[model samples]
Target: MGRHSRKGPKSSGPDIEAATADAGADREAVRPVPGTGRRRRSVEAPAGSDGHTPFQQTGHVRGGHPEQREPGGGWGTGLQQLHRGDDHRPGARPTAQQQAAAGRQQSTGTRPLVPGPRREFVDAFDAPPAPPAPPAPRGPSIPPPRPADPSTSVGERDEQPPGGGTDGPAPAKDGKGAKGRTFTGIAAAAVTTVLAVVVAGQVTQDNGGGTTSAQPSGVDRLGPDGASRSDDRPTPEPVRAKPLSYAQKMAKAYPLAPELKASGKFEAVPGTAKAPGRGHRYRYRIDVEKGLGLDAALFARAVQETLNDDRSWAHDGAMTFERVSTDDPDFVITLASPGTTGEWCMKSGLDTTEDNVSCDSAATERVMINAYRWAQGSSTFGPDKLFAYRQMLINHEVGHRLGHDHVSCGTRGALAPVMQQQTKSLNIDGIKCRPNAWVYPPS
Candidate 1:
């Protein structure tokens, strides 16, 4: 069988050699197209059985050729010989060096022995090239254009409510017509027209005035300064008022007991100030009684607490309440009912004695104020006024003790000196003094 198979392919020799030579010639003749700069794949011999005999050779078109061959004994046949190098023989094992080299190649992402490029004959007769992509269409340039304006009138342009509108004062209405329909329409129109005329006139006047030089109101030029022009009106020397220290400021506000320096009391120990006897160093003995007279005591306590809590008052060491007493105490704090008498007092009636009856700065050195009249709303003045009066009276008597005399209201809206009799009536009589309206020196 082997002998017959070997001999069987002798007739196919000339044809196979001719095919092989043709394939080689085809490869040698292959060339790249001009300007493409790309090389074509070349054709090469197809390995097979029959020991490379030219007589056993075969030929095929690039894409249409069958891939398999017949078994061992025939020309260009035998699948076993076709894939000879790819399969392992029985129990063949890789050498240590070979295995190590393969592992190294894998680790480094590299390999050897890739097949050479296709032969020239294959390149010349390979599959047709892929179709080229289509070209893009050309378009015209469009330059940006101006925005379309809807209307010419500024009012219409801005979509404002009619006639040459403005944000300021409303146009006055014409009072010439009656109060109904046509009157309103006509009046509105007339008013709008008048406003238009006035506005036009003002604009024209302004434009005209810009052309003329007006007389300078000062030694300086009417134009902006820096031209070295002097003003006839005394350039009031910019008297930058010296800023008072926090203490000075508080003292200026409540001069009776100028702001005191902070004692270590509040900060000494956490609860030290609030401690029973230790904290109660300043005992506030409120003289509670029936009648309007006692009301002053309550109000005084409120004032006392307000002053105590006042950060400004506390931080400054000018004064601190050791204790609050009613009468014959270090500081006698007396009160005035709806009707009370004596030198130090607060009442609607005009009475001045050893225990005065009006809320005023008496020469005496103890505090007297109205409690009932101030609370019951029947005071001749407002609570604020009564408060001020009471405050003044108290501070004033204290002032006498401190050696201060009667002083007037010097500031425009500043808190008036405790000695001042700023209230119209000694008692609350007219518009109550607003709490927020403090007295200050007139500018």
Candidate 2:
């Protein structure tokens, strides 16, 4: 018997992948034309056979119709003849249709395609469908470009409202118009009142000095040496220093931790002398902590400016202020850090740290201002009125030096007195007063 075949369940042929690796795998793969069911497969030789025959080759145009092939394994069309067999170059083999056409060409010597340029070859059997026409031309080139906007000479265009009125706000309802006119009148009146108050308080055309009264017009009693003698003038009424308000706890502590100078020395501010008759000219000194980071000059100027204002200590024409650097100044206003304030103002008996209040240390003769309070105004006086708060702080502490007593809010919503202990609550008499920096009303 012939050899009993034991190579059971054998593959019909070698996969295209194995044959692909045998060739340089870098070559492009061979594939049938799209839409063509024709397959180019491998027909391996029998297992027992020697692998040397051309039939030992891997993939080929298999299952070709005998009629499609030429009479003797030749081409049937004018396609270029394929590399006969086992050429290692990939993609060199003809497609099945090309192979069939080559066979026909070998049989008949005539070429089906005449190689010529400049002409499209659309095969009805394989060409794709025709393209669509381009979109219709967009409508008449819109807007035709406004005639160069009538040149700049057209003066400024009055931008009319959508309602077609001339340059003005759109017309409102009748009721709205009436209300708007009323509001405008009220606003104008309010503005006039405010202007009057501010003018009176700060200055008036009547008095060159902001105060209602100016320095008493007594001739300067010059000494025999020509210096004005101070002893000749009557002593002015002393401004008592005891502004009062409730001792309210701080609902919240100040948030800033500023850098301050620890230097114990004091620096005096520079300014001009007060004119005679404004009142008894009082000399004062201003100093800041050595490393206290604050602009000492600016702070001193603010204090000086505040005190010299018509609405301030000098407002009543009873006293005028002169910033001095004398060894024995009437008073030394010290901007002190919280810690320093505690030491210098310990006798004041206020918590320098948590109380956040400045003190006029009667014993030390120093107006010790808590730098924290200086930087951050109190809760009673919100930040919006920061400048006013600063002014009030200066006035209140200096009021202490001037012997002023604490005073409660005299009337609800009225401006609190400068001498009020307003760093605390102003509502001692169930009347919440607005924060005020000036002792006297607007001139």
Point to the candidate with the largest TM-score.
2
- Model 2 scores a TM of 0.42
State the lDDT of candidate 2 residue by residue for 219-330, as single tens digits: 6656678878887678899999774321121122334464343666555555534433368888778777765666676677777777887787787687887777666778
Q: Which candidate achieves the best lDDT against the true structure?
A: 2
For model 2, the run of ten residues with the poorest summed lDDT: 65-74
Task: Provide the RMSD of all predictions against the true structure, rounded to 1 decimal.
Answer: 35.3, 35.6
Q: Over 4 Å off in model 2, which ranges?
A: 1-265, 269-277, 347-351
lDDT of each: 0.34, 0.57
Query: What TM-score, computed on C-alpha atoms, does each candidate reach?
Result: 0.26, 0.42
